[model samples]
Target: MNSLYAMPGNEAFAELLSLHTGYQRRQLLLHHFPDSETLVRMAPPTPGGDAVIVCTLDRPDPKALPLMMAAATARELGAARVGLVAPYLAYMRQDKRFHPGEAISAKIFADWLGHTFDWLVTVDPHLHRYATLAEVYPNAAHVVHVASQLAVWIDAHVTMPLIVGPDQESAQWVTAVSNLLCAPSVVAHKERHGDRDVEILLPEMDKWRDHTPVLVDDIIASGETMVQTLRCLHARTSLPPVCVAVHGVFAEGALEGLLAEGAGLVVTSNSVITDTTQIDISKPVAEAMVSLCEANPTETARRTPA
Candidate 1:
């Protein structure tokens, strides 16, 4: 019998998931009204069979309601288990209460997801404050590392490259990507004046002027970090740097701004579907969900801390 069906914006990933785990691909029928409300019409999983809902939560508030409905309906119709594959998980940044009235948004969001789904799988969530996904999520959570795929992309596209990070926060991520590429890495010093205002100081790269600079980041929201990096690089190297990010959430014309700042080519993994998402992580996500399904059906062990 056929296995799971993927949601909209996830058709490509469904095809790759099938290739990885032999799970059949089908669609979840959905639509938006003139007033911007969502509707879901999809076949539930067969009795004793499972379902996987693939939804990328980039612009999350609008997407969450329908996704929750889909999961609930699948179970109402007799699904044995339901799993969520959200590659670009949102609202994961605010781990603590910065202000007095602020909500522990990440923990609250995790509660909603934990109570709704039996298992979860995602890629490179903002983990600066949290140690692991399990800490935020109350169930089986899998995080897909994008460095391997990113390294492959660099090898195939960039020549004589120097991997670089825009600030100290990106040191671990940049080092991981550089190690995979077997390329030298640099982490520039940066001070955040405000959310969008940042000052950067780059190291002297006069000796490696021949190499192309490849700026690697986990997420790009305002693109200021990259713009500053490109500005510093222009004085030392003649070539435009190839920019790569795991999550390309180009808010406020980040894509155009990067190109305007002399970025050679901007690219990212399929974590967040953007014009620059050129790499795929379907195999790792599929493997994670399938393993959860194969684990003892009790669902108790999945709640254990990772």
Candidate 2:
């Protein structure tokens, strides 16, 4: 038995999972915990003979107590194993400490949570320098699930377009989509002056002047970088179609600000819930779960660690 716990912020995502996995509604447990006390009080009576799967968003200072309590409850109730399914993983951007006083949040967070679950799964974590999920979750079986649905959406919608990676970090994403569509791509270098302030420099568009350009990035924080890139493209000549980001963490009106800056459309995966756009990633995510399940049948049979 699988007991899926869907936190308040992940209802839509849970519904998507159910649709794809064919997991019965009764198997899914939905609860709203505004605070730690609420979370403790709302904990399921018992998670007997079931593997607990937790789903929650990235909280600024995540309340780990609740997650721990849930895991403990699962163990107490004879759960075989526990796991986490996070579409938008938090504390991943700060995978390293640039300064002496800075903290390696990604490692710290992963280590802390590693004790609670046997497996960790997320969609396109912001790995900046790290190449694989193992670098972050060394203890748990880490599964990095990408939002391949975005490529299909772009192929169907975007017409006569040139894919652009906002920065070198986004080159992998740009390359993946461009290869899928057999389209050309370009990478733009960016410089950040301050929060929500950035500059983008792209090569002369003598060759790309006629083709529509679509900028792609992993995350859109303040939309400053993308806005700057769009402005730069506009100055040279008529700008191309628009931009798209994998994780639309559009902080503080970033989406509206990007649209106002002449961005025709902004697309993103439903990794994080947003108003502008949300390409469903259910099929891909479900496929990943199936693969993981098949890889380790013993994973389903093993008893919870005492």
Off by over 4 Å in 2: 26-36, 40-56, 60-63, 145-147, 237-240, 297-306
Tens digit of per-residue lDDT, candidate 1, span 89-165: 88898899988999988999998888778888898898768988888898877888878888888999998899989
Assess candidate 2 and give its TM-score to the true structure. 0.86
**For candidate 2, which ten residues in a row score worst on lDDT?**
40-49
Candidate 1 has its poorest 10 consecutive residues by lDDT at 297-306
Candidate 2's residue-wise lDDT over 24-58, tens digit each?
33333335556535343233423443343546445
Backbone clashes, candidate 1: 0
Q: Please report, in order, the local distance difference test score of every candidate based on alpha carbons.
A: 0.83, 0.68
TM-score of each: 0.93, 0.86
Q: Provide the RMSD of all predictions against the true structure, rounded to 1 decimal.
A: 2.5, 3.3
